[model samples]
Target: ILIGNLFTGNESMGNGGAIVVKSNSKPKIINNTIVNNHSLYGAGIWMSCSALNVVLQNNILWGNKASESGNQLYLRSTGSTYSIINNLLEGGVDSILFETPYSGILQDNYMFSPEFADYATGDLHLTCSSLAINAGSVPVVNMPLYDMDSNLRLNGSEYDLGAFEADAAATIVSQPQNMIVMNGDIATFTVVANGANVYQWEVSTDMASNWAAIVDDTIYSGATTSLLTVNSYAPMNGSLYRCIISGNCPQVTTISLPALLLVSNPDGFDENPIAVSVYPIPAYDFVNIIHAAGSRVIISDINGRIVADYAALSSDNEQISVSNLNNGVYFMKITSSNSTQIIRMIKD
Candidate 1:
């Protein structure tokens, strides 16, 4: 599926500067922006002598120039069939050249100029007043869930034509923040995004080397909602958490920054626990640990396996060599006389 893409800034001395589909190539071109190409013939696309089915839907073909022939599309095939639907063709019907006995379905297509945000700067995002809005047919198959800018498609009552979906308030307004929760307490992280978005909570022990989706289990609930709640436990200490926000459009996935979860045992801890910090989050060869001078540090993996142990000689910041370790999430447990704290660390 050729979906949710932009094809531009191309020039050819001959035909089909942007695309040329020859015989036996049954490609489905959907939700694409093809613009500003120059060629002798078929500046945008050319299909010649194909014996298979060619599908083109929800595409934007604009600002293409041809020297002497077809400006947008040139179809010259005797045995091929096509389905061209719900596309915004800026060029008129004369821009397309079809052979005799044109066997294709052409319905709900538009020929008006699609008012792009900035055609000169190649920013083809649709404005609110664009005619391409709500001018498309619903797809039967290969439907994209998101639009070009990771915005949810079908945000309106119907699908919009062209590559981008016009939305004024469809964006991630706020992201989840980091939190510190006591063991056995409830930890909640919330995100404030707009539009018809889908949310999935994920946890990674190793900075973000690998992420596992959070399901609606006993310990974790509200995994699919904007707010995610987790019943904190000792095992959940130092685990990194984040949310994945996406829409129905293809390739419209966004992962938020990792939030550190520090699970403290409040019952046995002193009034003031030792302050600690670790960096650089995604460490390559080594990671620096800043903590109390007499603290003892232990590094362990998510499986509770101890990887390294160190004793701080002085309060001076200590650096641990992690070049031999594989890239993944690990926890650094710093223990002092009064309290213990686990900090999440990642090896890159």
Candidate 2:
């Protein structure tokens, strides 16, 4: 598939000043700009014999000249089929030269001026008032995600009928900041971006190389959203985190700088402490705290207000119901016979 490209400023002697499709090749040519070329036949493009199944959609063909015939395009093939839709042609639909038995679907093409931003300097970006805006067919199958300059495609209500999409820019508004938290504390990182974008959070233990994408599971969730939360911090939580924002119009993608995550042992907590596990960092309804039996658990919000207090009576695992709590950061204090541990939890 030849998608999202620009071809211009060429001259040819035989045929196809810019592009010539040979036999047995089925190329889908979409969202391209071809202009200012001269040739004997098919000044802009030519489909030779036996070139079967060609698709030309959302393209701009203009300012091409032919010595004798077929100023913009020439098709000479009996086995060829085409799908020509939502294109802006210079000399109208009559500019195409087709041999007998032409087989394909052709509709919704424009023949008027395309109103480029700057035609002299080859700036083919469409103007706001151009007729090509919102003139393309709906639901293009296998359409390219980005345009020629890596901007996003389909900026408006539908795809535009040219190489460049309408006015759309993807940019990051607020980057994720560095964070430091105590062991077993809940740490959250967030990024804010504008435009139609997709978010992906990644973590790197070795300073930016060998990054791994975070996934939604029992331990970690919201890996694809703007917010990422680490439910319980351990020694391994002292890594770098970053977010990638992409899927803008004209197809541009960008990544934010890695932010540091420093996980420290709790105050006065000894090394090699009791093993405790917490699950579902951004807890929606409940949070599970697994520890030794007979351990006392105290939950407090950011303001040191005690919310829940319980003791592990019969088993080492306890499920604390937090469905009534608002969304914020909370702390948990677990005290055993020989040790005490403080954990951070997030209620969503």
Best by lDDT: 1
Give the per-residue lDDT digits (tens) of candidate 2, residues 162-275: 678876544678878778677777888888878736788988764344689999886567798889988656654436677867643333345765666766664444555668
lDDT of 2 at 280: 87
Expressed as tens digits, the lDDT of each residue in 14-94 for candidate 1 is 878788888788888887789998898888888885666688888889988889788898888768888888887866666
The ten-residue window of minimal lDDT in model 1 covers 246-255
> Which stretches of model 2 miss by more than 4 angstroms?
138-141, 169-348
Off by over 4 Å in 1: 169-348
Best candidate (score: TM-score): 2
Candidate 2: what lDDT? 0.76
What TM-scores do the predictions have? 0.48, 0.50
RMSD of each: 11.7, 13.9
